[model samples]
Target chain A: MTGPDRPHSPSGDGTPAPRRSPWRPRSRQGRAGPLTYLVLIGVTVVSVFPLYWTLVAATRTNAEINSVPPPMLPGGNLMKNIDLAYDQIDLTKAILNSLIVSGSIAVGTVMFCTLAGFAFAKLRFRFNNLLFGLTLGTMMIPPSLGAIPLYMMMVELGWIDHLQAVVLPTLVSAFGVFFMRQYLVEALPNELLEAGWVDGASTFRVFRSIVLPIARPAMAVLGMLVFLQAWNDFFWPILALTANNPTVQVALNNLGQGYVPDRSVIMAGTFLTTIPVIAVFILLGRQIVGGIMQGAIKG
Target chain B: MFKARRRAGQGSAPYLFVAPFFLVFAAFGLFPILYTAWVSLHAVDLQNPNESTWVGLENYRKLFSSDFFWNALENTFTIGVISTVPQLCIALGIAHLLNYRLRGRTFFRVAMLMPYATSVAAATLVFSGLFGRDFGMINWLLGQVGVNPVDWDSGRWTSQNALSTIITWRWVGYNALIYLAGMQSVPADLYESAAIDGASRWQQFRYVTIPSLRPTILFTIVVSTIGAIQVFGEPLLFGGVSGHLGGAGRQYQTLGVLLYDEGWFNYKLGYAAAVAWTMFVIIVVAVLVNTTLARRRWRNAA
Candidate 1:
């Protein structure tokens, strides 16, 4: 059920626009003039300034940061501030915990969502459409609605302060399932499945040998999205895990709420917490942009 | 015999594929939600969640009468409008600009999305520093322009505006990209035809781009509305030590922060559940209203 097909090529990578012919009329999508560049540059600066300031604040002393006309440039105290942040809170443990938690969630969500999405997209089964609709419905449920009871459930299970407490509940994202289902519905072809069945392969066997390979790109995109979400997840993890055993976001929360409120140390922790995801973003920015655009059209 | 066995295997396979998601969701997702509805009907404390006293609609009754509840609802509405309206409008403009053929398109896109990549806690921490009373960058910039250094956290509108700025900064790029995707899908000939008919750039955008992107605009609005209702970590971490209170006057406390306050700080687990449920109801009503409006628009167009 393709809607309006994308006017651009299917790759949808941010390829440079082709050179316009001199004879052609200037349409709305014509080459941008000087004014567009000025506006875009302004927006980009606004976007990146906060993140850049995080680094600057992290490098300065509390007094320097709080002074009138605050220090716009970074100081030489970054390493020392980072060390102080480590002493103030369990920064190392928090980063390690975040890695474990987000890694497990990404892998788990990708695996489970791919399987369920494949079924919803292709297989004929009882209540297939209805179950798919139910999964979509779950996305609309505000996460706070389940927090109190989920917290109580964690308490009963003795999972409070445990990594699994945060990891387990989030491993099955409705959006992940929906995203995969949408991708597979279009990217996968029926003939491929028929060929696998004709070869007498078991469904699971076919899935492993055929579906998995086909789903790799979408899986990678979903994995990155899920990882970023889990890493940045605040509300649930703050509830389920304690400060003693915290993720990056939880540690940042503690840093912000500290009694003395060391601005440099807090900024250092915030910088440290954000760097890994930002690194990932830098390495895979184009793909992630494509993924969001692709998801937007499908969604 | 082989055919029959293969048919049997196929019959059970789809269920096997879907069972994991359903099982996990049943335990962690669906059950907890229904349990929250039940929890709201009782008097439960954070210290002793197991010992819940059934209070019927007492928690709901208290919520209706609570001034804090109304204040939070009002704050949520005001902040939602302030943040979302300007955010979407700016996003539309940025998306329109980005649609023009430009150099370094990838860099522009990735840079604009940097804020989205930043976690709420980190972003809020940085923005709070920028919005600080005496020595903040925003105030410092305003001072250079012959304006007084405004105390960002002192008044209702001021604090709310500060919070809205944080929300807008984080989300505008994201919504712009989504809008750009929608604009890209618009048939180029629609623009060509408009241009042939002597429509200028702004006229073409107003006439063609906006109409073609209605569904996409609606999608972003609905998503942003849901996010606005649950605006948590930004306000929670905005006011330093008294962050959970949203401000000294609780001026910018959203429903999300209020839920945390009722449960964790006040230790009223039951009342918090009631707030959570009420939020769920509001989201549902809002989404339904959006859908109805969209449907009516389509009918009139038809």
Candidate 2:
């Protein structure tokens, strides 16, 4: 990828571009005290050590985990422990179920939120502010308020033990709509939308062609957020689906809740379930953090 | 031409665009709230919901009188305060550090978020092992320091501490990132001017940064309070297998857990709905009270 046109193409001086900022809180740029580094490293270690411990315990036998001065490093029984977890619980099925549910939820939420967000952000309609305010108000209604009746409705719909019970209800999040609206209001230009109108494009056509590409970045962040929350959701899925149709979070809960719990197998299951999300974080860490911070500011 | 075309689709297109959200909300979100309110007034059993008898505030009465309900509320507040107070302070400190022109800033920022990114189930289970009575890392570490092994799962305060530790670990970074975003917006010249005045770093942080970050702090406090009131997964997993109703004596059961226990386990749908409504009322009141008090404090400080 390196070429003469590249901004950071190696100059004769052999120094890469100065990427660090000079406008941080402290005027003395690049002069962080050693204590600052030490504290940051300590925080990083504390943040990551529990997950590492999960891995360490998962790799060891239950006896090793339970013994005095438990094995702190990776052990050789990783495969055996994972196999036990897989056999005891249909771990693969849970993973597949989680993927399907979370994927549907994320995609559905993103689409619906984008459409509504575009309307509220750009399209002129009577009662627009009131409607958007209504959407915002829904965010305050705790999910716990609707739990019992929502479960009952699922049962009445004969959606019990179905992934749709978990997926469908959450497909249109209020926060998602609000987030997309805020982002699109800033990212999208009214002139571009007007240009579409002048070209005889219908609203839907304008959204499909002109707005979708521009909103892709915001949609990706919102989709990732919805996916992570859906993947990690527990209480509803636990109530909606039976053990045979468990999502990963529910499956992990079952594993952790077993009588005479096997520490190795539980840890192994935890590790397996978390790998997808951790992988997502590694890949989309910047976007996720950026989206969260943006959400806070706009919210 | 643009105005003419825009007027053409003004009749139904907007409604069509936003129909899905409203439709879904109507079906699942709005209807359920109304139904829960309706069911809260009746003696509804899970098995025979069709034949429920109207109780008419009886469930609310029973809930108010029940010791378990009050105990769960008390525990929820205790765990909420324990976890949220220190979490915000630490988050503020980390955010302050993060605002500095440090090396590998991006790496540190990303690393801090790993806790918030991890699923509650995974995080709780890992903590369970770390806080285990025997052969646990915390106990082992304490032993090295010539302290007694503390039982995290038993007793009242210790179990709450264990739960609070998990909640704090999971959320502190998230709040910190929010604070960091707020910090980045503060005019850099404020610090420069303060420095010119020879204000010490601590003094600058105390007077300048703290005052400037008031709105962000208020936002976090309201959000944390809302989140803390419904703290469920941590205690559920912390209670261990078959220990979902808090601890053995319901030592750490929150209102969220209480609703689950009453509705799912006890089949008292009516009572559970009452508990849910109570929690809703309490959250609204708490948020209002917090906002007013914080506003008053800000005025007094000024």
Candidate 3:
């Protein structure tokens, strides 16, 4: 309900978005009406059941898994599965490769996005609108359209099997820049910068002193998104990863071709793969949601 | 003097602040995409790059004439429509359920988003197990109702339908979270006013809530459409490594999968590039239609 050109209207008609329909509904926050906590909790259970299943399945032996109802409890074979996976696939190496590729891509994306976002959001340059529009317009340019050329470019650059091949291509994601710009546009207070300038603070000094601190929450959100994307990414890395520098995902895929469906190790690899994503989400779910909403509303 | 010093000190700062991105984007982002267009014009082969012949419109001609390309196009659209409409609609319903004065709402809200953050690889793996013909949970459930188990990945419709179910399940909750956010933004006073005016909950939703959520709905529609069109990982992982072939007998493949097959798997760089451009056009066109229709719905509802 925020208006760009106008002063804050709060919630459009002065209702202030109602503070989410009252946090607690009278009789008992525990249990009272048809709006019982159990129903919602049930939903929460359903949603997380698959994740729990993944963890459980990671522990079970293939035959135990093939049992009628499937085990609801974790099996003792988790360590064995991990050991087997390490033996068959380069589990440790794959994890390290994933970290390097995803970490580098995430860092590269943040740097490019923040820089471009800072330029677009704060610059008074001519054609700033045009540049931003062009950037935004490129958002609609599907990634597939860029795929063939990107592959050729990688081959030309001799980066095909290199982790750099994956990192370099998606470094300047439009969504990243767009998300950061929107966040900064909201978070940066013009008066502070103007005041800093009045007291002889340079633009860089003002930005450093005034903007970056306030932008941490937003940046963290963008950073998490960047990390999530890099982690979940399959295509470019699959194209890029060789036997030497295979990411976990590619390793798992290749594992399928290499073995006759070793469910124990596959489950282990999948579970290991999911951990980083879950950790990131646990830490920064709110920022992710907020940043995403901010980006969508404004952009 | 202070202002002058300030201006001088900060004169190049903005450019400095912004250069890293522009440089990287130029090198990796802009350059390759532009080169892809040039590549799309030629008869370039990844295996034999030196034998590149600049056959003008030849790649485009070949892509346009190919039956597989058309099939991919059709699959992409069909799957996108099937998945997107239901995904967003159910997402809206889930959002509403969450918005309703449900206890443990916060739990549901967060639970709903778990699917969104889940690795597509893991989820697809899980889904493939669930959709297994012999022992899938789905087939078991179907058998309890006395329906025969269908070969979920064999026939065109069955395969695409199975793929779309996974797509729908993964996405519906994600979209619901989006709708929940949008719903949270709508002024409760509007609902209050509607309530006061003898409008029932459903009517308030039909009249007030839906109207306020038009922009959000439009946003979701566009996002869902793009997401569906770019249906890569599911088909790639579950469908096959040779994703361009789409599905078994090429029935379940989307444009994204097809684009990969042509460009990377098959080495039909030029033809694949054309296919990519075709997808780009389709996505743009779909976005346009989504926006137009959303606006119309908003207006008519108003």
Candidate 4:
């Protein structure tokens, strides 16, 4: 198949056709008509408008934000509102807390999932299928079912208002293991392991040198996904931590639910919470897109 | 010597490698889920969780008899349908558009996914602001079209619709990309054959594309249904101050918010556990129903 990004040549091939056919089916697929572009542009606008409006609202004063036909354009109060939100809530601490929590969870999930996935995919062991099936089954079990007991456990452990309370429960996801296992099954060749075995390399050594290198791409993808999930996770974090110590999502929630409703300040807090992830998306979007598509095919 | 070393390594290496997951799952996952069942059978106060009185089936009975529980269930179902149906349909359309080779293909895909990158907290806050009863952009836009302003927060349908809109906005792009991946895998010759038979684009889409995308569509539907069943963050944040109650009249209280409200707000741990288990059963039933229906459809086709 031709690459999606390649432009459709008039002759419908890299080498010019001797003459164009009355109906060129192959190139026609590549040549989207005007209506298609119009629809796509419409969808794009709808997709982006809310985030854009968040920026607009964040820059305006509450009075301007609350005015009818609300300020479409940004006002000059961006920094002021941000400052107000910062003063009202410990946003900087929240961001730092989020980074630490998400970072640790991401690293932990990737490490544990890769190890488990490698074993599931390549190694032969007792109850291998049974164990792997259990892992997959766990994915179907909703996290909410465990909330009450987990909350009690957290309380018993004195982990309330602790970042670890939020981090530990989510440190290893069943989905991460499944994703890595799928990737490894396809990507890791058994011959490599056999070669290592023949070379007298222990399983751990082979894993460290050979498996890790081969699994790096999948690990990176899983890490990004887990980090995104950890960062955006609200339900557990809100339950575990209070306003005094909150992640970005928890802080944003507090800001939104503040007794004295300040729309602009809330929007400012929303903007602050969202921008870091958006910036990351902007930078690594292509890989993230690729990762999702790749996972879609396998999953 | 090497064979002996390899055998020794193989004997324990896999177990050691896989231990972390099992250990963590035992500690955090399996235990809690099982303990939730235990908790559900007892009346456990949030303040004194250790002290519990066994009230077998009482929480479930109370839930079955409670108006709020029923309201939340109804809200969850209605919101799930409204959100998932339109979201998937729009995603399929977007995917079709994306399949056609367009300039800035990467740009469009990445830009559309920005909402997915935005957290539920951020997205809900932004959407709630936009859907404000007064001075909101949506009402302003509707006013331009001679439509009356909508009290998006108060009314049952409006509030649910607003919550669903937030869900749709966040997920449509992600689902579109999933569908696009499926679309890309459809053999080009099918489309070519259809075109040669003088099929129009709409006909091609109707006959060729949708059939080819059955598994992908089913996958999205199941996934979306699972997500919708657990709809919490959007409704909770959308409620603003009384976030846990969903709305003043419980207009849009999803099962997830109900769980939170019962446990966190009302401090009824036993009742929340019942809600949680009920949700679990509902999800399992939903998955089974989907699977059975899909299998039956496939059998019929066969």
- Candidate topping DockQ: 1
* Candidate 1 CAPRI-style tier: medium
Poorest stretch of ten by lDDT in candidate 3 chain B: B239-248
User: Which candidate would rank higher by lDDT, 3 or 4?
Assistant: 4
| Tens digits of per-residue lDDT for model 4, A1-299 | 12212133111234344354655655435567899888888888998999898889899999998887577898899898998898778999999999999999999999999999999999888878999999988877777568889999998999999999999999888988888887788778888889988987888999999999988988998899889989999888988899999999889888877774678888888888888788998898887887787667633
User: TM-scores of the models, in the given order?
Assistant: 0.95, 0.93, 0.88, 0.94
Clashes of each: 0, 0, 1, 0
Q: Write the per-residue lDDT of candidate 1 for residues B121-232, one digit (tens) a residue.
A: 9999888888888878999999999999899987999999999999999999999999998988887768889887888889999999999898899889889989998999
Per-residue C-alpha lDDT of model 1 across residues A132-225, encoded as one tens digit per residue: 9999888877665699999998898899999999999998988888888988887788889878888888889889988998889889988988
The sequence of per-residue lDDT tens digits that candidate 3 reaches over residues B1-302 is 66664545445566677677667766666666667767778887878654567878888888888888788788888888787888788777766766664544544555667777776777777766667687666777788889998878677888788788778877777777677667767756576666667776678768876777788887787778878877887887675443446655888877888777876677777877777667777777888988888778767866
| Candidate 3 ranges beyond 4 A from true positions | A1-43, A256-259, B1-16, B101-103, B240-244, B300-302
Name the runs in model 1 displaced over 4 angstroms. Answer: A1-8, A11-19, A23-28, B1-9
Clashing pairs in 3: B246-B253
lDDT of 4 by residue, B156-261 (tens): 9999999999999999999999888788777776888889898888898888888888888888888888888999999999998888999888999999999999
Ranked by TM-score, top first: 1, 4, 2, 3
Best by lDDT: 1
lDDT of 2 by residue, B1-302 (tens): 55774665465788899999999887878787778888889887876655568999999989999999999999999999999999999999998887776778768877899998888889999999899888788998899889899888888999999999999999998899888877766666687788778788888889888898899999899889998898888888888754568988899999999988898889988888888888888888999999999999999989
Report the TM-score of chain B alone for all candidates.
Answer: 0.95, 0.94, 0.91, 0.94
lDDT of 3 at A171: 74
Q: Give the number of the best model, judged by TM-score.
A: 1
